[model samples]
Target: MDHVIKTLTPAARPPEAPGEVPAAPLRARPSRAEAEAAVRVLLGYIGDDPDREGLVDTPRRVVSAYDELFGGYHENPGEVLERTFSEIGTYDDIVLVRDIPFASHCEHHMMPFVGRAHVGYLPVERVVGLSKIARLIDIFAKRLQTQERLSSMIVTEIDTVLKPRGVAVMLEAEHTCMSMRGVQKAGSRTITTQFTGVFRDDPKEQFRFVSLVRNGIG
Candidate 1:
């Protein structure tokens, strides 16, 4: 009988080296002077006076805000998934968590794409703690992104870290870049989804996962 396993394969060993020096700790981020200058230029190009009192500190505030908004660029996602707990039982049903809210900055217009994510995975041998899923979402969402890429990134990260038999991710969001400007249509939401393994091949499984997220299992 062919076995369907979802275990993490051992990574290939690096070539044996003699006396490899320890790598240096990561250094602090580069100065924001360049970004500040860019902001000043943008303000002038947009016919706004940058030297006015109201706009005097705007560049500095924007620089500081961007650091927090895109802090995920500095985080290591694998470390977030390093710890795990094994579950013992014959019980194997879809584990779904829904309505995980996140706020991400749009890479295109630097506006916000606020949304909720629904994530599900079929356990192969172990289960991750619930909070970790939310943490993973936050880790990825804090970076500049678009809804489609963000949805796929969440699904791929969970698949890589957990090696689940199946994984599904759905995101529902409002893109302020579109609503607050350009098209200027509020109340319109964007939905993006990604699936893999059994969830990709089995429509029923995918539907079930979606139903559970949209409507509670109860």
Candidate 2:
């Protein structure tokens, strides 16, 4: 129940907010062969024998691993929410999908932060599929991210595409950068939450959401 709650990057603008400029498409940087070459260079720089029989294929493996690690670049969050249904009859209260587990790379160190997400939205008229919420989380999680940016991006994507009456997101993650290196505080976790519309404007609604996310905890 105890965790750190601070933005990893303070000066950068939040990923949400009306009129925020869309992120420019990232240009192609290196081909797989080029990436493998770079990995080989790194192995050499680290004083490893790149051509040693045991290490010769490492560069190729690393490149293949990166393709999966950073695949969020190819995903469009809006598209995932496009499949929705409005068939819920008079069921317009909070729709929550909790304990959605995910992993993401920290943009600063390219290390991993693993966590579970709690996402909830007050429906206006339309509601997206439950699995779509999990898939939405996955799409964003596959990218290099700061937890701050990641949480905002999730809420923004749901609100923008689903036209939800409100959105609430809570993410609790353990950053490997802190646990494996840097300060090296293993087991330290980070908790972050964001809200928009009714979840932000109404305290009772916010409290209800928090309680639900924490599973009725006060």
Candidate 3:
């Protein structure tokens, strides 16, 4: 049986005020044709003919994918954590969620970095639903990112929103830019870690979190 934790409520994401910018605009302000034109120039610079039958719609397709891939840019991560619930009535031990899948484009190469994130936090007063944790990952991962910054942002956001006693985030991934081209090392993986609050102050707690994640705990 799946152990469902229904006690954890879905956190409310408050709507932006009047005249406020939406966290993410579903529609792009600029016309799609302009985006398509930009992609056409990019393909041309790469020595590809944008007008060729095989490549004719490539520009438009790229623009469409770009809209989905970078949609996080228009969204605020903080808003995902705006509402909190404290009915659990306890705050002492670490809360761990592992194998949170994510995909990102490397800022350096614009190539894909696919990986899993392991997040742990010691709640001080409140908690958020598990889905929100994944949403947090999306907010940072959907942008061009360095793994280091991504890990740091996860911890920072959790710290800010939950006011946790401590937070820890670890990401391990293989970058397509590294594995598939240039100085290719096909199986190479990068791991990044960030810790704050109690996790930083207590080495034992930090080690426990790391060990558990490495051992494949959920």
Candidate 4:
């Protein structure tokens, strides 16, 4: 099937420094009733009776589900790493949180892509709690994203908040849009990685991070 692509020109903005959080683009939001009405339209588009017994409440349920699925937009990424501990005596090494499971919807199709994220950072003097890193992953995962941009955003947020010497992030996911539709290839995984500072500058550090991610200490 052929797809029609529309090109949109965005408004110009001032330059942003590295690690600077850009302002979110403003958009007029529809009311809950309007949103529900839109869902009913979609139901009708799919050749279903929106007023049918089983589907009578489907619009409300779908809107509620959307609130949970896309809650990231309402969260603050900066607050996730607001607190850090700097008292560790000479502990300067990679802090890795592996096998963090997450689910996100694709921006193109809004289909789910489930995955595991492996995140690591070399602390300069302070470090945030391990659970905070997991929360950081969740903050981004609950939004509509592409795997590549997701990995970059995670790395950028950690680097900006923690000011680590370096950051390494790897995401492995299977997009349902591909498996359930399109080519319909099942059991295929897509892996994306982003490295900054030392991890990006030095091959050895990148290798160590990858090795630790692949083979945890025995």
TM-score of 2: 0.88
Better candidate number, 1 or 3, judged by lDDT: 3
Tens digits of per-residue lDDT, candidate 1, 106-144, equal 988878989899999998878878888898889789877
RMSD of each: 9.1, 8.3, 7.4, 8.8
Which segments of candidate 1 are over 4 A away from where they belong? 1-30
lDDT of each: 0.80, 0.84, 0.80, 0.85
Model 3: clashing residue pairs?
Answer: none
Name the regions of candidate 2 deviating beyond 4 angstroms: 1-27, 216-218
- Tens-digit per-residue lDDT, 106-149, candidate 2: 99989999999999999988888899899878878887899998
Steric clashes per prediction? 0, 0, 0, 0
lDDT of 4 by residue, 1-218 (tens): 12233322223232232455786765666778988999999999999999999999999999999979977766666677888888889999999999999999999999999999999999999989899889878878888889998898889888887899999999999999999999999999999999999999999998998899899851
Question: Distance from true position, residue 178, model 3, in Å?
Answer: 0.9
- Residue 47 C-alpha lDDT in model 3: 94
Query: What's the lDDT of the predicted structure labeled candidate 1?
Result: 0.80
Error of 1 at 122 (Å): 0.7
